[model samples]
Target: MNIVVVSDHAGFTLKEDIKTFLESENHNVIDCGTYSKESCDYPDYANAAALAILDGKAERGIFICGTGIGISIAANRHKGIRAALCSDIYSVRLSRQHNNANVLAMGANIVAIPLAKEMIKEWLKEEFEGGRHERRICKLDID
Candidate 1:
C-alpha cells in the first residue's frame, strides 16, 4: 500500500522512525516535511498528507505531532478526510473498522515507539466494517 506521512517539528524524529518501519514492511511511503527538528507549522504537513490521499497519490495517511490533536484537527478540516487520533491498539483498530478512517494520527510524545508500531500495524491491516458505520461515514460527507 502507498501511504503518506507528515509531521511538524515535534514529531520529526518519530516520523522518521515510522517511515523506516513502513518501508521495512514493504509499503511505499511519502514523507512530508518538517525534515528537521526545527519548529514548523503542523497544518502545512497535515494538509500535504490530506491532499495526497484526496488526489489518490496515497491510499492512506499518517500524521504525527506533539499531541496529535492539532494535526488531526487540521487534516479533518478536509471534507473527505477522516483523521483519527489513536493512542492504543483498540483505538487504532476501531478507527479503521468502525470509522473507516483514511488518516491515522498519533502523538509522538504521548505514545511509546513499541506501542505506536503496534497501533500502526493494526491500523494498516484492519478492514473497515462498513455496516451501520457506512451511514455515519456518509453523513460526514454531507456538507
Candidate 2:
C-alpha cells in the first residue's frame, strides 16, 4: 500500500516510529513532516496529507497530532476524505469496513506505539462491507 503520513511537533517521534514500522510491513510511505520536535502547526501537515489522498498520490493516510482531534477535523473538510480518529481495534476495523475511510488519525498522547500498530494492522485487514454501508458512506458526500 502507498500511504502518506503526517504529524506535528507533538507527534514527531510517534510518527517516525510508525513510519518505520509501516515500511517494514512493505508499505510505501510518504512522510509529510514537522521534521523535528520544534513547535509547528498541525493543520499544515494535516492538509498536506489530505491533499496527497485527494490528488491520488497516496492510497491512504495516517495523521498524528497531540490529540488527533484537530488534524482529523481538518482532513474531513476535504470532500471524499473519511478521516476516522481511532484508538481501538474495533473502531479501526469499523472505520474501514463501514466508513470505507481512506484516512486514519491517532493521538500520540492517547495511544501507545504497540496498540497503534495493532490498530493499523486490523484496519488494513478489514474490507468495506459495501452493502447497506455503501449507502451510508454515499451520504457523506452530500453538500
Candidate 3:
C-alpha cells in the first residue's frame, strides 16, 4: 500500500517511527513533514497528505498531531478524505469497514508507538462492508 504520512512538530517523532515501521512492512510511504521538532502548522501537512490521496499518489493517509484533533479536522475538509481519529482497535476497524475511512489520525500524546502499530495492522486488515455502509458513505461526501 502507498501511504502518505504527515505531522506537525509535536508529532514528529511518532510520525518518523511509524514511517519506518510502515516501510519495513513493504509500504511505499511518503513523509509530508515538519522535518524536525521545529514548530510548524498541522493544517499545512494535513492538506498536503489529503491532496496526495485525491491525486491518486497514495491509497490512504496517516496524519498525526499533538492530540490528533486538529489534523483530523483539517483532513476531513477535503471532500473525499474520510479521516478518522481513532485510538482503539474496534473503532479503527469500524472506521474502515463501515465508513471506508481513507485516513487514520492518531495523537502523539495519546497513544504509544507499539499500540498504534497494532491499530494500523488491524485497520489494514479490514475491508469496507459496502451495502448500507456505501450509501452512508456517499451521504458523507456531500459538502
Candidate 4:
C-alpha cells in the first residue's frame, strides 16, 4: 500500500515517526513535508497529500497537525477526499470500514506515538464494508 504522510510544524515529529512505522511495515510512503519543526502552513501539506491521492501517486494518506482539525478540514475540502480526524481505535476502524475514508487525520497533541501506531495498525488492516456505506460514501463527493 502506498501512503502519503503530511504535516505542519506541530505534527512534524509524529509524522516522521508514523512514516518510519509505516515503512517498517513494508508499505511505500511519500513524505510531503514541513521537514523541520519550524512553523509552516497546514493547508499546504494537506493539499499536497490530497493531490497525491487524487493523482494516483498514493492510495491513502496519513495527516497530522496540532489539533487535527485544521489539517482535516483542508483535506476534506478536496472532492473525493474523505479525511477523518480520529483519536480512538474505534473511530479509526470505523473511518475505514464505514466511511471508506482514504485519509486518516491524527492530532499530535491528542495522540502519542504508541497510540497513533495502534490506531494506524487498526486502520490499515480493516477492510471497508461497502454495502449501505457505499451509498453514503458516494454522497460525500459533491464535486
Candidate 5:
C-alpha cells in the first residue's frame, strides 16, 4: 500500500518513526514535510497529503500534530477526504471499517509511540464494512 504522511514540529519525531515502521512493513511511504523540528503550518502538509490521496497518488494518509484536531480538520475540508482523528485501536479500526476513512490523524502528545503503532496496524488491517454504513458515508458526500 502507498501511504502519505505529514506532520508539523510537534509531530516530527513521531512521523519519522511511523514512516520507518511503515517502510519496514513493506509499504511505500511519502513523507510530506516538517522534515526538521522547526515550526511549520499543519494545514500545508494536511492539504498536500489529502490532495495526494484524492489524486490517487497514495492509498491513504497519516497526519500528526500537537493535538491531531487541527490537521484532521484541515484534511477533511477537501470534498472526498474522510480524515479521522483517533488515538486508540478501536477507533482506528472503526474509522476504516465503518467510516471508510482514507486518512488517519493522531496526536503526538496524546498517544505513545507504541500505542500509535498498534492503532495504525489495526486500522490498516481492517477492511471497510460497507453494507449498513454505506448509506451514512453516502450522506456525508452528498452535502
Candidate 6:
C-alpha cells in the first residue's frame, strides 16, 4: 500500500520509527514531516497528508501528534477523508472495517512503538466490509 505519513514535533521520533518499519514491511511511504524536533504546527502536516489521500495520491494516511486528537480533527476537515484516532488494534480494525477510514491517527505519547506497529498491521490487513456499512459511509460523505 502507498501510505502518506505526517507528524508534528511531538510525534517526530515515533513517525520516523514507523516510517522505517513501514518500508521494511514493503509498503511505499511518503513522509511529510516536521523533520526535526523543532516546533511546528500539527495542522499543517495533517492537512498535507489529508490532501494527499483525498487527491488519490496515497492509498491511506497515518498521522501522529502528541495526543492524535488535533491532527485527526484537522485531517477530517477535508470532506472525503475519514480520519480516525485509534489507540488499540480493535479501534484500528474497526476504523477501516466499519468507518471505511482512509486515515489513521495515533498519539505518540499514548502508545509504544511496538503497539502502534501492531495496530497498523491489523488495520492494514482489514478490508472494509461494505454491506450494511456502505449505506452509513455514503451518509457520511453526504453530510
lDDT by candidate, in order shown: 0.94, 0.93, 0.95, 0.96, 0.93, 0.93
Residue by residue across 8-42, what tens digits does model 6's lDDT show? 99999999999999999999999888799999999
Count clashing pairs, candidate 2: 0
Lowest summed lDDT over 10 consecutive residues: which window, candidate 6?
Answer: 134-143
**Tens digit of per-residue lDDT, candidate 4, span 92-142:** 999999999999999999999999999999999999999999999989888
Candidate 6 or 3, higher TM-score: 3
What is the alpha-carbon lDDT of model 1 when measured against the actual structure?
Answer: 0.94
In order of appearance, the predictions have TM-scores of: 0.98, 0.97, 0.98, 0.98, 0.97, 0.97
Tens-place lDDT digits, model 2, residues 21-55: 99999999999897999999898999999999999
Clashing pairs in 1: none
Question: 1-143 in candidate 5: lDDT tens per residue?
Answer: 99999999999999999999999999999988879999999999999899999999999999999999999999989999999999888899899999999999999999999999899899899999999999899888656
Q: Is 1 or 6 the stronger prediction by lDDT?
A: 1
lDDT of 6 at 54: 78
lDDT of 1 by residue, 1-90 (tens): 999999999999899999999999999999878899999999988998899999999999999999999999999999999999999998
Collision pairs in model 4: none
- Top lDDT prediction, candidate number: 4
**Model 2 weakest lDDT span, ten residues long:** 119-128
What TM value does model 3 have?
A: 0.98
